[model samples]
Target chain A: MRPALLFPLLGLTVALLFAGSLLTGPAAIGLGDSLAALFRGEGEAVVLVMREIRLPRALLGLMVGAALGASGAAMQGLLRNPLAEPGLIGTSAAAALGAVIALQTGLAAAFPPALPLLALAGAVVSVLAILGLAGPRGGSLTLILAGIAISALAAAFTALVLSLSPNPFAASEIVFWMMGSLADRSMLHVWIALPAMLAGALLLAGTGRGLDALTLGEDAAATLGLPVARLRLAVVLGVAALVGAATAVAGAVGFVGLVVPHLLRRAVGARPARLVPAAALGGAAVVLAADIAVRLIAPDRDLKLGVLTALVGAPFFLHLILKSRGERP
Target chain B: MTLLALDRLSVTRAGRPVLEGATLTIGAGEVVGLIGPNGAGKTTLLRAALGLIPAKGHASLAALPPARRARAAAFLPQQRDIAWPMPVAAVVALGRVAHAGSAGPADRAAVERALAAMGLADLAARPATELSGGEQARVLIARVLAQEAPLILADEPVAGLDPAQQIATMQVFAAHAAAGGAVLASLHDLGLAARHCTRLVMMQAGRIVADGPPAAVLTGAHLARVFGIRAQLSEGPDGPLFQTLGLL
Candidate 1:
């Protein structure tokens, strides 16, 4: 328990932010009242809004952020590249398409909490496609290409579904999903995203040592008693589960995985164990900050998280590419 | 732990045979040097022993399957560039990951000893990406040593070192072997291999051409045939040595 990496720090931060997330909203809620409503269970309307709506939303975001961050760290460490990001290969996009499919087809309205599961299934499909097409080069660029291919296919399928649909509601919902947002999301959305994200977080963190071994190189990692195939499968499933669930709810929030993990690599010194947790905290911080910005900056406009992150991430990506190219020749 | 036993191993990489068939054994307290011309499979043979590459053969380390085969066999690959900026201590600690869950008090002591063994105690705080190539070599060797494993495999480990650094690096491997930890190192320099290693395994093209003591395996004729060059062999106070006379 080094003081810098002290578990207390995590507990304190999570608790403080968890309360902050509940307290701060458009409804002019205060900490004492929220706490009283949460415990006493007397202020029914206030309690429902606080407990049922805001609390679940905050918890879902926390879990999703943690999942994306952990998986992103594991992915980068596995590929041994700083520029590698989780969804660059298509998990998030596929998840979005999956959610879109469920919503546009009326399955989500028919079966609550199944949209994220649909997203999960789509994520698995895209991950499988990437692995099959990539041919085990296992580098960042190859994974990115595989992701792009899978994403394009999934996107086309989603667009086709929307175009063929007769309902205007379905088409508008598809457009909302395409842009990506977490607005007016309900309890069902929270339930759909939380479990998958939590499971994915555990699976990804369990591979922290394996990811560290992978930094030695794939061949070396296998030789070091890390079950490479099992780990790979776990990474794919776990990332699919997390990203799929998150995208189902949040609608394709890009580069929180990439940006948060990259930033924390420097903070935690790039050891996977330290990096994973640090990235988790960093991702939560980034998403929370972004969510707060979305609320404050454009209350009426409904700013999409995907758009904001991409706007931020694209420039960072260009900066990275330039830096990498500069270093090479 | 035994160094390694590779019984009739063959490897195919990308549908082409890299090592057709090779059988080799390394024993404890022995420094074995593997040398050959380009495409010689010197690296392949060592990799096979360590189970880095899949091979059609029986490769056994001390503790067999179900348990990890090569956990005791630490390796340093030919060409490695650190992708992330890792601190020296953390990189060295990676050696302990295999043993971390099961480590006794002894393992921790060994890690510290390995750090001191390679003279990296001072540079532990420094970032690995910042170190000089020669220093990086020492740090990597320190990592393998920290594994506290019985056998160490290094592929072309001293390729870029100056003569002094090369000799200094050889001494570290020599010290590991002297401490009853076996070493199977792939090398290019005939002189360094002959001087430091107890035995030599020579490959021409994916096959072992000669396997014997340095004096026998590194004869002028073998050097000329395998490397296609002339070389002078000498008996020094230390041991048999070689000096390469430009290409034949």
Candidate 2:
């Protein structure tokens, strides 16, 4: 597909999904009335539900999904591995660990900013560790192996923190947070995550040309006149910032990044630079659609968004592995 | 004009010298072949001179900023793996990345000319990773050609190519030199090197042992001492003919 058509189509899908998400919920509100309540504030009760309840949820879904998608594409490009994702590479898990620490210790309750801040710190550390373990010239196997180790370590720490939590309520809250959902998120949460997400998006935006050069390999990329070290730094920080903020606000939504980029790769002609923005928009569409599905499938039960994404993504990942294995052998 | 100049360049890795005190200069309208044994540091020297690794002494191209250096020189590493399934045209277009603005007509024309040069115009829209090994090698060579830089540094460029393709690729580099560009390519194929390269530099154990015309550099003494082999060298209708007889 031509880029001119693909981007607009993706943008349209996200927009339609955004509208669908706004209309989806337990309270049955007509589309026109909801739009009026959201934009015009004509009705009190519907407006409250539209502006306060659904608006923030849809907005968070868009932001979280876009972050995951962009970061995943960047990570894959940086490591030259299609299987690389923030969730798979321990970045999201590390961020979750930090968020859990904040919640279990009541740091987040006392100081709300501590949550995303510590999560960002954890994300930065894990990304640095992964890059160190899997050097720039590392192959896919080494990269995935390092990611497995880091992910396992982060998960172990998270489990330990949960097991040792002194307050039973805090433990349950942390458990719910780990399930990854956009339910009950307010505009305040959106505001808190906005700065970091914007910063991350901006940083990732510039990495397209660098990532394109890197498709040839490290030495080749460097000789192409790319500052490979600086590009690596930007990718690491950008991915960390995006994952930290997304995990802080929405828990650990897995697979959006991986699945979105994979699906859109061919459409973008598999160019890493073009894949970034396409994946961003595609991610938003997937997340919004998933959020809408959660409401439709188990509206009263409050099914988590991560559960749905993993259900779809894990099988896709398996298919990818099988396909790649066939190609290799 | 001197396109690339290295002044006593040296590289040390893990407290051992991988490339030692090599001084050379490549001028426009020249194709210089770098020939050596497996561990004789031809790759290390090319990498160090391109500033892909740290080294003592000076590589004139390495001193410039990244953008300027990229515009001045293009490198094709021995590992010719394409990470993504990008189209061949898109991969070739990556060569234009160092240029400041978005791609323009000149960039498109360069890519077109490169594809034609590598005889890959028909495969421009094909996925690069789906091509065979030799085809992929040509695609990568086309990518380097698309850069339109003054100098190209290629490592073992003809290793996987068939004899005909190897000669054709050499002719491409020769054409680049004829158009006032330069190339410094590492090769194990002494025949190809002798025929295609205007000059030859032979290295032994991290040091350049010979640097001159093919006849002068690939002498019996240099071949025996550096490569541990005896080779026959004679003139042919096309160019210099080189053949390896037996190990010394």
Segments of candidate 1 deviating more than 4 angstroms: A1-11, A109-114, A128-146, A163-169, A312-329, B13-16, B100-105
lDDT of 1 at A157: 87
Q: For model 1, which pairs clash?
A: A89-A147
Candidate 1 residue-wise lDDT, A83-170, digit = tens: 5667766888788788888898799889856677788788878878878876544544676677788888888888788889899988
**Candidate 1 per-residue C-alpha lDDT over B84-113 given as tens digits, one digit per residue, 9 for 90 to 100:** 678887777777776747356666676678
DockQ of each: 0.54, 0.86
Error of 1 at B104 (Å): 6.4
Question: Which DockQ value does candidate 2 get?
Answer: 0.86
Q: lDDT per residue, candidate 2, A117-198, as tens digits? A: 7887788788889889978755556767877898899999999999998899999999988889999888888987898899
* Least well predicted 10-residue stretch by lDDT in candidate 1 chain A: A1-10
What TM value does model 2 have? 0.95
Best by lDDT: 2
